[model samples]
Target: MTDSPNSATAAVTLVSGPAGTGSIDDFELFYARRALGRFRARLGRQGLLDLLAADIDEGNAFLRESARASDGGYTGGTTVLSTQGLGAGEFVAWMDKAFADENVLLAAQPEHYLMVGQANGSVHVVENVGPHICSFYLGDWAAEAMAWADDADELLPKADFPYKKATNLFLADGTIVGRVLIQFGETDDGFTSSLTVYLPASCPQDVLDHHLRHFAVEFRNWITAAAAARA
Candidate 1:
């Protein structure tokens, strides 16, 4: 922790007092630790969408459109979501069919995570992890990794996504050892359309491995399933 004459103390600060951080997004994930979390498959598409909709600010429009309708604020805010995990390509195809968008961008990434865009104002942000699609709690994995990455860095960069890094590692069970970032971006068959998934290099090893495995399996299944149905 260093201090300077020209900044907000040159140290990390918490925003949980008087104003409750005003906006949940205000909380800076100065460091996030990664841990071994679990994932389970949900019953159906709607089931998964419901879970993703939780905790999201509603004014974004995509959530509103997907979950039926809403008042336009709590149900419409910027709803950037992280999937438990998914195959980069398969998830996009699902979005293409589900939203019936002729121009959807689905990106397959190295860490078994996928990023899809529901930018049309009335679309879905869905990812199909294997049967373990429920939830993979990165434990404080991403958090701790973020901190380690922070101290080692001569710089402090923002995720440019809904996620962030924070401190507070030391999980009760066992301490997570390591983590990293994987980036994936893709465009539709048309070339001018796209979606980008920027996962910071702040995550642990096993957790990262799981996503890689998850992506490989689920993505293949997604493609196979789609082909089977078509045939």
Candidate 2:
């Protein structure tokens, strides 16, 4: 595991599940390593938003930075969410649908180990063997759609959107790891978004799962906070 230069308080651990062993127990073991903690952001909220709102390549620079720090492969590209904004409940429903969607997996032989589909939100966990990667993403259908759009089109129209927020976290089990949280929303000005990252190069599937769940819970709270701030 390596420590992230951006976050002195955070560390990233590299881990791999039992190789060539695919069983229900192994699946369970993989996810059992889930852990969580918060880390300081490398850049302020406005700065991160500037990066995301910048040209397409720069917009995704944060993900690449995360990939480098974690020493793990990451999903490239952006996903622009749907036009239909969602209420909190609808957001949860969208997450359930997204978790059920099979296309979210990568080229690797992914084993869908655990799935948490709740009325408030959803989390999909998978182990990607070929690249030795484990990833968990939390967001609703609208958020997913937005991510896809950003991934598909680099120079997306951002004039309609403003405000972005991101935060960093230090995740640990036996050792510390890097994790990131990112959120993008609409504002009258430019764009609003947030992001957090945890480190070494790789972390266990369960560890990632834990962070994913953390994001879901915090996201609901963020909705309330964001709304309150706007009001």
| Overall lDDT per candidate, in order of appearance | 0.30, 0.35
Over 139-218, each residue of candidate 2 has an lDDT whose tens digit, in order, gives 44343344333443232244533233222221111111232334455544322333333334443454344444444433
Q: Pick the candidate with the highest lDDT.
A: 2
Find the number of clashing residue pairs for candidate 2.
48
Scored by lDDT, model 2 comes in at: 0.35
Which runs of model 2 end up more than 4 angstroms from their true locations?
Answer: 1-162, 166-176, 179-181, 187-201, 226-231
TM-score per candidate: 0.25, 0.26
lDDT of 1: 0.30
Question: Candidate 1: where are CA atoms >4 Å away?
Answer: 1-95, 98-198
RMSD of each: 21.5, 18.6
Cα lDDT tens digits, model 1, 1-231, are: 422223463455454565544443233221111110112122233443465544222312222232233221111011112332334344445534633422221322212222332343322223322112211212232434554445433222333222232322111132221232322233233111111111223322332344445445434444444444445
In angstroms, the error of model 1 at 49 is 6.5
